[model samples]
Target: MTAEHYFSAEPATPDQRGEIAFNVAGRDYRMTVASGVFSAGRLDPGTAVLLRKGDLPDAGTAGTFLDLGCGYGPIACVLASEAPRAVVHAVDVNSRARELTALNAEALGLAGRVRVAAPGEVPDDVSFDQIWSNPPTHVGKAELRALMERWLPRLAPGGVAWLVINRHLGGDSLHAWLVERGWQVERIASQKGFRVLRVAGKTD
Candidate 1:
């Protein structure tokens, strides 16, 4: 049997499903999870820190948001709940993960606002006002860079992307690389060996 990887386009592992509960910004959430997805066991620590420290959109916020690499729609659910006026695009490579996200979004009554899709399925005309992710750094540097390269450019003018990466996994270096590439990167928070980066599109 092929040992399933979170990045697998099709996770061959038998679905071992689970549920994880968390509270963000005083809102409670219980979401479905399954094997062969990133951080399927719990709310990942880096994602926790990113949600805790990163700026979230408000109820009045009206714009498009992207939850890049959404595994089971936790961030997408939160964004849809908090910003009812906004639309959320949840993108992932794993089909199983996308399925779980769709289920979770419907369960949370957020299916109307949360659009779950494979990375390639999102419409090319859709641009994000804010992007949120705890990227899959285990995918290796070159692939990781390529993932970011493809999505980050879809940020609208003045858009911001919030990312949390393990410090041991080249967090600082990635921040530096963004700077070198003309992204205005800010180290918003550092905790539990993870760095939260706030990257703004460079305005000419």
Candidate 2:
């Protein structure tokens, strides 16, 4: 299918390796990427903004953290690095993406801290203290909403989620949807047509 379909469970193309570099919280990260993952060639701008603006957990932070649509484990890696005591669960449907994320975690010597898995593989009893995502908005609005519906509730009470969505790609609409669903949604930051949303403390 199209290169835009990174969420496909099985990517049609062969894995072609690439690398990208970016900084988060004053630390630079260089990671291997490949076809079948999100943003194979470079750091995603929205993710960069999310990492730059979203609140990062400190070393004392514990409990599980979910990195939804983890790509090559950038978010997972950063979460593990920042909160060493926390368990980071990285979930993606793409097999190649999961493979690369696991590889990247091992390469970065974070394998013990990061757990890469398919969405269904995550234990039902598990909940997260924090969740982070640069969601696959191109997957269509219905799919995007379903994705959020599935995972957002996995956040523990008082837990927070950081999401980055392109403004033109229904960012505002998604914010409204989350609010309507009773999540306290805040537009924490914006850059390069992307909206960084901070979700926490549900309220009707």
User: What digit string (tens of lDDT, one per residue) describes model 1 on residues 21-90?
Assistant: 9999999999999988888889989999999999999989999999999988888888899999999999
Specify the poorest-scoring 10-residue window by lDDT in model 2: 1-10
The per-model lDDT (C-alpha) reads 0.91, 0.91
* Off by more than 4 A, model 2: none
- Segments in model 1 whose C-alpha atoms lie over 4 Å from true places: 1-4
Which tens-of-lDDT digit does each residue in 1-204 have in candidate 2? 365658889888888898888888988888999887788878888888998899999999988999999988899999999988999999999998999999989988899989999999999999999999999999889999999999999889889999999999999999999999999999999899999999996884
Residue pairs with clashing backbones, model 2 = none
TM-score of each: 0.96, 0.96
Query: Cα deviation in Å at residue 169, candidate 2?
Result: 0.2
lDDT of 1: 0.91
What value does the lDDT take at residue 39 in candidate 1? 84
